[model samples]
Target: MEPVFEFPLSLDKHGPQTLARRLHQQLRAAIVEQRLAAGTPLPSTRRVAQAYGVARNTVIAAYDLLMAEGFIVTRPGAAAEVADLAQWRQMAPRTRTRTRTRTRPAPPPAIDWRKAQSSEKPIGSAATAASARGFHLGLPDHRWFAADVWRRLLLHSSSFALPDAFGYPSAAGRPLLRAAIARWVAYTRAVVCTEQDVVVTSGAQQAFDLLARVLVAPGHTKVAIEDPGYPPLRAALLAAGAQLLPAPVDEYGLIVDTLPADVRIVCVTPSHQFPTGVAMSLARRQALLDFARRTGAVIIEDDYDGEFRYGSDPLDALQTLDREARVIYVGTFSKIMFPSLRVGYVVAPPWLIGALAAAKQCADNGGNVALQEALARFILDGHLAKHTRAMRKRYASRRDALLGVVERELGEWLIAVPPSAGIHLYARYRDRRQAKRIATLAAHHAAGAQPAGDFLLDRQTTFDSGIAFGFGYIDEAEIEGSIGRFASALRGSYASAD
Candidate 1:
């Protein structure tokens, strides 16, 4: 039987040592150093020669030399094995010193790593995992996704016949996916753009990060974000060294008049404000556009879940309203399809697309081309729109279930902010002091409710203390039971507080 050798064997043709000599030295060292234990079999000469691209004569000569030195033993029609070296190991001279030197402690790092990680706090309590079941924020019902259809599309897109499918993908993203995104956004969100204006990204987070990398002048750029805004976006901007200014939001959305005049960038969720679920008023939308135009500041419109509105006609996206090319619109499939998909797009002005594409190239060289192609087909085939419509109905039912339960059981203590769109409901606690306590206690009762205070950018800001209940992941049937658990926790919190 052929034997196996795990030790590495190398030969340098140009070196002073001959091929056979070098192989012999390495094998000898491996056996003597105990890397090759006693009785361990060595590969056949032909196998060694083929494996290392060396001649069989060189391997045979090396084996012959080792056998002569009594380091190896060979039998008729059998591979060579390491010799018993127990006596040799005992007689070997000891080289290691008895005393050990003390190792000095490493000096502190120049950059404060703790400060860098400060922005990574979960939207809710850090004790509970963010993706925990029962009302966890920003998670879609992944069970409803059309896995079979997606798999078929993936298989088709990755066909070996298409050479471009295997090549290095475009840094700006695949043309078909970009064009699909342009058409989808234009039809659904009223976003004004063509294929040239779109840049496909891994997800909304990467889109924000790429924009931050390109636009932010480290430590000097002043960027304004909503007080209770998306934390991941905040983290991306902070990593780029932008000075974050927490702008206030009321029922109308971001208070445009209150924004600092010198701010260079404004990031807002105007379609449906995150956590609060308040759609920005048309007057306020116009006011923000005017503000951006007057201050020469760019606006990043995160139309995260704008497609699921249940009430009146949805307002035009900020990108649709922008006439001076000051808006950068970002959208994601995480809420519409599933978070793991990690597909999103950005619609920017023609001039800025180059910088964003370059930044994207530097970040990841581009997203998965095959996946992009499949997603493009998914969009073009109308599967995305169909899936979204079905999920919207499902989410709407879950939303109603959650709202009904919250109003029926916990209405006295929790006053829900009127929700016009989106899958979550934010309710301010009537007693501000007990809101955080209730949210913490609810986690122990298996209800994953997040404190509104946890999302606030400026903790000192005079916003009402509340809780956010996400309905996207929770089933309609389970909503009542989850709310019951949360209610029990609420009563316990009140009892303890009293």
Candidate 2:
């Protein structure tokens, strides 16, 4: 004999509330309170109607309401069972007076987050303010992106008849996209790799995170990072329990001699250093590689915005010069394309590829298949190359305008740091103390910029005070006026300081 399903609910006959509504409310409360536990089956509608002395239609209506609200589930030839109410329990009314006196103690947290350092907001996260006439960093001009072409490709990729297209994608990545990335990097950045070497990631941030997880042995590995470097990369390494050693950078890029001898990994932006906007000299690149070879240290070369250059031919990438297979080349389409596309790739040596793919699998199961397919077509069809050429010209124009205006208006207070490539321009303050004050004042005048001190790991470290102006967000027509406003702010700051 089966157990009888009972409704421990009461209905008020004289109350203004309808009996059906009353019954529904009580049943919902019971489920929320776990009085009717998840998966508990309910009696038949006829049995419920007969036991409660209610109309059969009333019982059916209440059950229908419960089913609609997801409080219960039913199928053909099966009794209605209570649905899992874990999510619903969280949203249940807290103001309701509890009939039970016992309360369960909350479980302890899995990780002690209080001891962890908070990550800084990544560059280009200010997309909402990109349209404003200000110097926002790490943003690409989305106006030139071929959205219609991308839309068509996205639609086409979504309509594939292959069963594999709809299933969980390969953790290593779609072979077509990997091949496309391999070819694209080989031609553009001269990174030597094949499809077997590429591992697709959500973004450059995820690439750093996956690499940290695979390479860093929590609290044991010593990783040397460029001081005042990319914060997201630092956050990832720190989270993985690697002890970070801050290596100083000069005009030619990271100071290889300053790197600790015991360091197991070195993270660098050789093509174009962040915040400083200086490319690594060939001698320094070779020295760093030699250091890696001697000490068995791995190098992560982040060529984030290397595609855009203003002057003569850029130097060969560090990855191209690496002979020992110690370099892991990381690149992203975010700078060339839009940031929200969130597509990046890593070209690792044969030995590290397996570990990176496994880490990627554990991180996100792999990137979006449809997006990967669309990007592969975008690259193989020559859309990315054409777009790069067009944007490079436009960005160059804006860069020129910013340089001319800064020299003409703010020459007395700022000295521009000449950059061979990349979208942003870095300028040092004539007076170090004035960098932060001037930047704060400039923000009020709609000329937003970041103080260089914000990038340093140690705030008290003696370094040149400077500011970075990203021309990617501001248009050519707006550069002069925005810098002019910034010039006014500089004058005001100087006057107050005097």
Candidate 3:
């Protein structure tokens, strides 16, 4: 029978070794190593030749050489088989002495990498569901996202083949995309900037990383981050060797009065304070800008979820008020669009744009060309604004539904933190210790519960315990059931505690 086995053999015509000789040597070595054992059938000459992209004569000659050397046996009208291993071993006498080789241990690392590593879990570590259900943070409802429209835009970008489109994209991003972003932000977020001031990033996370690389002086640069802030931004600052100063946040957002005097950089989610859904007060924004101007500190304003406001006019972005260009506005389409899109941008001042562009170039070479082009078309054609408006209405309805459930069902166990904007709302637990316990219970009920301590810089035990409930991801129709499940989970946790 013709044995079916992958011939893990190759031919290199460019080499000094001929294909037939190389094949012979390989087969001989396989037999010696007992890889091709006794009675193991080899593929026919035609099959081996076809598999290796060589002439049939090459395979025939190699097989003949192996047969002549007594490595293989072939009978009339029978396939070639490996000769008995015992016969080959007897013919080739063992003359060499055996020796044992000792392995040396690898040397210890020179640098203390432990200090450079982060002890805290990454952002959205708990949001591991295939689809966002109850209370999953940072996830928008993917089911509502316009997949068809996005597909069309992507195709539109691919349809026209410009010379530059075929090449590697610019590190700063495509000119069209940068322009579109500049116009879009200027109109929507009150972020006044030209295309020259924008540098497209993989996401808001990469924007922070690139900024850290350019602005931080490693081991000397002092950066101030909100106490219960976004983990990724804090981690980025820490990784850049900045001495992180965790500033406290109140109802109005980051308390500028509490900021340390020597901080050279400040990162804040001023639009809607992450996990807390509190917009930074106008007074606080002015104070922050004044403080930045006073100390020459660069403020990184992460306007992640500024577009989903239910009430009140859109607050002026920190970048809009920065007459001195101290505030570097970072925005992402992940929350506004979908997470996997991996498109975000930085509205940087002219002075910092060049350095940031260079840093981006060194990071991933450049952004995805087609993606950038598609996003550019998506923005310029008014699809982005249209989608965002539709999402805002839907998200607002979800917000109302969540608020209703919290007031009616969860009022006894938790108190709402008064959410004004953003996808999630924070609720302080009646019993602080219950915050950690409820998360596991919530999971059993097919839900999610993110503890406030997960976002804290120091993770102090004394920190007030609360849970962030994301309503943007789950449907309005499912809101009642999801909230019921959440209430059940809370009750279960309390029962266990009793």
Which candidate's lDDT is highest?
Answer: 2
Position 394, candidate 2: lDDT:
92
Error of 3 at 233 (Å): 1.4
lDDT of 2 by residue, 14-59 (tens): 7898888888888888888777899989888888788777897887
Highest-scoring model, TM-score: 2
Cα lDDT tens digits, model 1, 1-498, are 233467555688888989999999888877776878899888778888887878999999999999999999998988789999776566334522245878788998643545545553464332332355677777777677888999999998888555686678888899999999999998889887888898889889899999998999988999999988888888788878889999989889999988989999999999888777788999999999999999999999998888887767888888888899999999998888877788888999987999999999998887888899899999999999889899989988888787888898889788877677777888878888766566676566536667767778898998866878887777877888878876887777678768
Q: Per-candidate TM vs. native?
A: 0.78, 0.81, 0.78
Candidate 1: lDDT of 100? 80
lDDT of 3 by residue, 325-397 (tens): 8989999998888888888999999899999999999998678888888899889988889888999898888
Once model 1 is optimally superposed onto the true structure by TM-score, how far is the C-alpha of residue 443 displaced, in angstroms? 1.8
Q: Give the better candidate number (1 or 2) by TM-score.
A: 2
| Model 1 poorest ten-residue lDDT run | 120-129
- Per-prediction CA RMSD (Å): 7.3, 7.0, 7.7
Model 3 Cα shift for residue 168 (angstroms): 3.4
Backbone clash pairs for candidate 2 read none
Clashing residue pairs, backbone N/CA/C < 3 A, model 3: none
